[model samples]
Target chain A: MPIRGSDRTSNRRAGGSPQRRLGARKRNQESLSGDPESCSPSDPRQVFTRRYRASIRTGQEPPSQRCSKAIHQGFELEVQLYPLKSQLVLPGDSLTARFIDALSAARLSARNGDIIAVASKVVSLSEGNIVSLRKVRTTALARKLGRKFEMLPEFAQVVLNEADAVYGGVPGVLLTLKNGNAIANSGVDRKNALGDSVIPWPADSHRSAERIRRALNRKFRKRIGVVIVDSRVTPLRLGTTGLAIACSGFKPVRDSRGIKDLYGRKVQITLHSLADGIAGAAQLLMGETQETIPFVLVRGAPVQLGGSYSSNSMTLPVKDCLYMSQMPSPSIMERDHG
Target chain B: MPIRGSDRTSNRRAGGSPQRRLGARKRNQESLSGDPESCSPSDPRQVFTRRYRASIRTGQEPPSQRCSKAIHQGFELEVQLYPLKSQLVLPGDSLTARFIDALSAARLSARNGDIIAVASKVVSLSEGNIVSLRKVRTTALARKLGRKFEMLPEFAQVVLNEADAVYGGVPGVLLTLKNGNAIANSGVDRKNALGDSVIPWPADSHRSAERIRRALNRKFRKRIGVVIVDSRVTPLRLGTTGLAIACSGFKPVRDSRGIKDLYGRKVQITLHSLADGIAGAAQLLMGETQETIPFVLVRGAPVQLGGSYSSNSMTLPVKDCLYMSQMPSPSIMERDHG
Candidate 1:
């Protein structure tokens, strides 16, 4: 079941006067305006809405008893499945078109306060982020680094193919060839697309989200939210959870300091990653294989919406140090093709 | 803001056919004339209630712009904080008595479907789980193992004090001295409680929960759920979340397979962990330090009461390879107190 607001009553302690005030503000704002779009600028009221909800069909095992036990105690598990649609082929925008068409065929609509989750692979394919390794020239540094990391020739070729310019390289750590994303091999992809072609990360996911949101709103005649999601490695965790690479019409962070607990004790150093949580939930629906659900509808979330757009606000600086540096390089992108 | 259930429209997508059957079963059970004195068995029909609500407080900063964006996109954030109470002392029944008395003192006028969250520490103390490290006779193996783990002499003494027998140890891992908790130094405690004595892990938390539930029912003449909660180390996460060590008068698990999504896709492998979610919510009220709220009342959860108690059902075995192995251990009962 989707995590809901009523499940959080225990968090409101006896003497949380500060939390009460915040709750009152939100309640007041919600009461004053029935719809998010009606709120005026400088109202201090944020409005949010659901964009899309997709349910992927999969054959994965149910959560183990241990995982279920954890959930019973209040942690949530969300999965997203992205199965290759048979009607669409890779190496073209036809897949993107088909995906959009499928949503429309289903009569799926995005609304203001909705966050639509789209797979990064779909975005990459639509933007023609594919690279042909055969046309690329590899440098001496690439050769040495490839040998050290046991990287295959095709993988190295693909990495070199996507490079705008290669940064410094060590045996295992090949610096990014791009400025925006510092992923190994510059976020190149070799798997899941078409044959013999590698897909590079989308040029600007934030822009992509905004564009999609705008297009969907125009098509549906309603306001909507968009979240372009990718699976990223977290520091020290074994498996991967989805991350919101770009978002429109949502707040991705929450700060809880100077807040009082139920017993009236002040809360400090509590900032929650709201986007990551939702992304994780969406990922549960969008699975690794055999499940084709790409989008999820999130409703009943309390949030404020506005016309102003800002993607930089979601980017975490390298100095923050919360992210792990040891994420497996995009070598998997190249190695998977063979 | 607490995580609330999906709106009525979304319920069709959120609930499965099996869940619907379970809901039917619950309704039938509610209508049946069963003896009210016996504790009700927990089933899939129960919608676990969160003890805390994650909302913006007056003095607190709103969610970060990034998070706000996610929220605006229909992602929700619900947090629970469990603050440890400090006013009560340990190793005595009086603390339990006081807690029960305080609970009884609180008006018993809550609406139906309210749950009372109780901390495990107080239950452990009342059960005489506290130990005095100064009273132990340390073995040479204990000393050697203590040196390897950089354990303080007092902490080592506490471990020895609690053990019925000291088993041999590997290089970094300490074999349990008793009760198979597999904890460092047999789950000895030094911090959080007042004074120089240490505390051991609670024994038979399920029994404790059942006892407490029966006691409360007799006293209040009301049907309510009781959850005994403790903070546990998750395999992959950095920090701790509360777990339901034991529960009475509620179905703590939910199975959601064969459920149809909004688009009519079958949902498999989606069992909701109602108990753990409730426990985590309760933790928000039972803080580790400073905040003195150890109990919370949760209302409006959709669940059915049940008989039969099993704490072992909630324990995730260490054998799961997918589970993280390197979570930081809690400082309770096993800290270096020089």
Candidate 2:
């Protein structure tokens, strides 16, 4: 449904005084009306809309993009990346409510189609998916593997539980297959954990994302997308960027295998992966370590919406993965391709 | 380096009317000053400053961050992405002048220390880094590989010429190392290329990036950084994000080893690759295709400026690369590591 002016005002006022205190933003947004300056290059919304229209013919966007033919009159088509400042999220807390409240406190309103990107670590912690080193039952195999990657047997035991299969290990890192994604140590991090434990991934990240999306939708009476994000290394590339382990609220990909390019030429091998792209953009502000900003609000990205999405949409079986199919290895792909 | 209000006003006016016509933006900006509501979460600049300061102690940022301890009085710490709408760029065009003109036409001003991200395709085009398939001489090896990947022998010859060494061929793709980076067909793209040809990586991307930076700095009389960006696939992950193939003005990495996290735990094995991070952020707006906004301005990322950097800073030898070291290969790595 379209957002009416009174509806927006009432919504802002209902968010309490902190939201109402945003008089400047509200006033400024209103002042844009009847203003020719809104169409100028200085207006961010105009810039986005202009670029969006120009790129449509180029086939640069996913076909699922919502704003393909939009002239965008008076539309605030701005994609704002807001990094929320939150406290240390501990294990077993209600991450869903925690995020909603924090967003509200940050005065970031949730509307019909806002995406809330959360770091997978925070989701895992909230789900109490952590294992204590003191309570872990480690096997001899666990101990041996732990020594290879400079970890304790307990951490290895937890990793073994979380991993679909352990690929191999070096002195400093171990390659593991988790939720069909190639990750290091199953993305288990002890950096911000309490006492003697580490947080592994939530067993059902897709369901976790769905649950959060549903909760936010119920509370706000509006549809909202949720993406549980993690940082991963790229092949032959340095450092890490955000990867969407799970998503809900839209189709996460644009498969353009036989799609035509701008010149009507068949464009081969172009899949615009929307989820991870948004995650990567969010990761620039949600610093990996102490920037306690696990939550980022990505507004106006032109992504489709619905709660009918799944993790399966983003995963590729090991046997079919291009990186695995071409590599010399004794993993799942060995049986199929090697 | 402190930008006074008068200085900012004069700068806007000097942008020659397009910037001066930003009456709405100027009004909004002025209304923000001395308004207690601006101190709220509604202000984008305040939001950035708060998050930047909050994340500093976590060692999440590069130590040389320009805004490390800055008590930003009133500044716009924004990352503005502008997709330049331009006609097709032919080879040998002065990319430096073209980009400056496009940015100015869009009313974008380059302040001191602003980073400009250029897609490597445009850089290669400007450098005349195209290989005409009609002019190519094919070897037997080229013909053999060409048949494997459905490429003409002449086109395959260009790949051979650009490659440091061919690792082997898969149907539809060939792994080759170009400019010390492992890439598919050595960064050759046929989609936007002239008919019967493809564009490969520039001869010296580092130098290309540096030359662009110098030209921009000379014209603007400001310390501006330049990064030539590319899109590459991640192993086992679908789709691509921006990668910084070459950087001109900053330490593009943030090594967080021996640093403490929020919990005072020693964070290990975390290297915040800033250039690629910024590039990844910029790519979301630039898109892969005809969204002509190939140029993005990444302002307020706390990165230090310097010119004494090279591709070496972002590269690791085949012998040391974890993935390549473990790969089954009889090419460069075998010669370099075996």
Candidate 3:
């Protein structure tokens, strides 16, 4: 049955019917922790967890309960995404400390081996990666890019500055290669920020992720992985899903080479992108709007934790990329180097 | 805590460490059905739920139970994938009935709005979509392709027959576009079957999905969606994730056009591929080995049910495809159309 919703509130962020938006502020929400010392800020409005509230509308067994018996019954291959809502992240705030505080507010503590997915925008925000478009001086190439893509000259300059290589564009969206990923506008975002201001990717995603991982480890006295995530569109697919810009504390790819298949044939080219898959699940919970869920705790993912890897581990070289390798033109590569 | 495994079985299908492979054959596997009349044939080996058993190894609460209280405490946004294992599917079996029986065997009834992800290989097997390499005659082009890609001429013939367009490849893999998806060997599989036989995509994916969806709705007396899925490698990314070959009973894409973003700017190009995301989650559970889990029941996925859509609804036209449209050479298109 469709999860029924109750306690209507005008929430545009969740991007569902009006009835589906059950603002967490009206509910008697409790933290997962029973610690009396736990505290939440004055405004306990958690727009991100509205999906959870929507499940309660029909007064039926929440899906967790419906499958609770399955766990005891010996059926347990599953993955869970918990979108942890927090106070508004401000520039220069310590992400690790802020995340810990958010977990406290949510009453959820970091569990050992949980992979926390932090939004790249928030990472940028904390790292002071904001740029004011009003101060940008557009070059001739930037103006040409603006006219060609139907974007503002200042925005185009920012995109050019961030993108490794620009391929082509539709009106308002440029297809660019950034850090070995084919992303829109090199992962520059205009939404969720003030006027004429934009947030780009963190300067060093791998380093950013490592710092968070170390901090969380120290704070919780537990082992956990960190994945820096950004919303990305798949080629020819609709809507956005999570992409791992950088990750720490795990082998990002599960290489299946030499592994025997069901028929006893050795696997050739199968490397599962563990980080990206986890990121996509987290992004599903962290909606595009002001859901205020910059962190998602992913538990029980089929990943081998306790390893350090670079962000490059998640990206394939252009010569090895399925789409880029197939392109008969060297221009896409030449332009990247150019 | 890492879920530890109790029993040990030599399971190459689950693709994990030895202790992690908790074969389901030894457990008191009771179906979700309390009814004594329910049957699970002679062998009730559910190698798929080994992950669940592993979770129980540490004497800790299963992740599901750990989050159970979250449901009652006004937190509810989550997605759960239940992998259902069944008998070895042979050619010409009725996929719909087989799926229903599998669900019954697991004692998990389908709830309305649950999306059932069926592996496309199983669908192809049931539809008699298998080809015998021994029976095929390799043409000159097939022979050329075989030498170039280090594949059998007979297998190359089959790939050529199934591929919409051919691209460059490495020693043992061919990059091709099949049904608007950039897939290896045009979605043909040589594993899991007897010698010299290969499985390709179902003849008509949309029709296959609709038929399965219709049968499910009738049998369960509940509304549900069906997605035919196949494991696919992402461009430049490692390993295989789920790709939706076809879907029925829902709008595959969530068009966010004209929707306001977090900052109230109208969303331009955000079409969420609900089917693919769900498919990927299901694939994570349905591993590449002989797990015997071809069907996964996904609950509470952020998707709207109740719609009829074409398979084309999930794919982009070549001209509109992000990667395809960026190629500077007309050769790829020419080869495709040729």
Assess each prediction's global lDDT (C-alpha) against the native. Answer: 0.45, 0.64, 0.67
Q: Pick the candidate with the highest lDDT.
A: 3
DockQ (CA atoms), all models:
0.05, 0.24, 0.15
Error in Å for residue B292 of model 2: 2.6
What fraction of the native alpha-carbon contacts across the interface, defined at 8 angstroms, is recovered by model 3? 0.32
lDDT of 3 by residue, A174-265 (tens): 77778878788889988777667899999888999999999998989877889998887665565566788999987777776676776787
Worst 10 residues of 1 chain A by lDDT: A48-57
**Arranged by lDDT, best first:** 3, 2, 1
**True lDDT of residue B143, candidate 1:** 75
- Candidate 2 or 3, higher DockQ? 2
Model 3, total clashes: 10
| Residue pairs clashing, model 2 | B83-B293, B84-B293
- Candidate 1 deviant stretches above 4 angstroms: A1-100, A104-107, A157-185, A307-309, A322-338, B1-338
On TM-score, the stronger of 1 and 2 is 2
Question: Which whole-number lDDT from 0 to 100 does residue B183 have in model 2?
Answer: 73
The digit string of per-residue lDDT tens for model 3 on B1-338 reads 11111111111012222232232221223321212333332212222123223332322222332233332222334466667766667899999878877676555777656789999989999988999999999888789878987999998888888887776676677777787776788899887866779999999999999999999989988778899988776656656777889999876776666656666776555677778777777776676764567898886666667667887778776676666677543223325433
Q: Pick the candidate with the highest TM-score.
A: 2
lDDT of 2 at A209: 89
Q: What CAPRI class is candidate 2?
A: acceptable
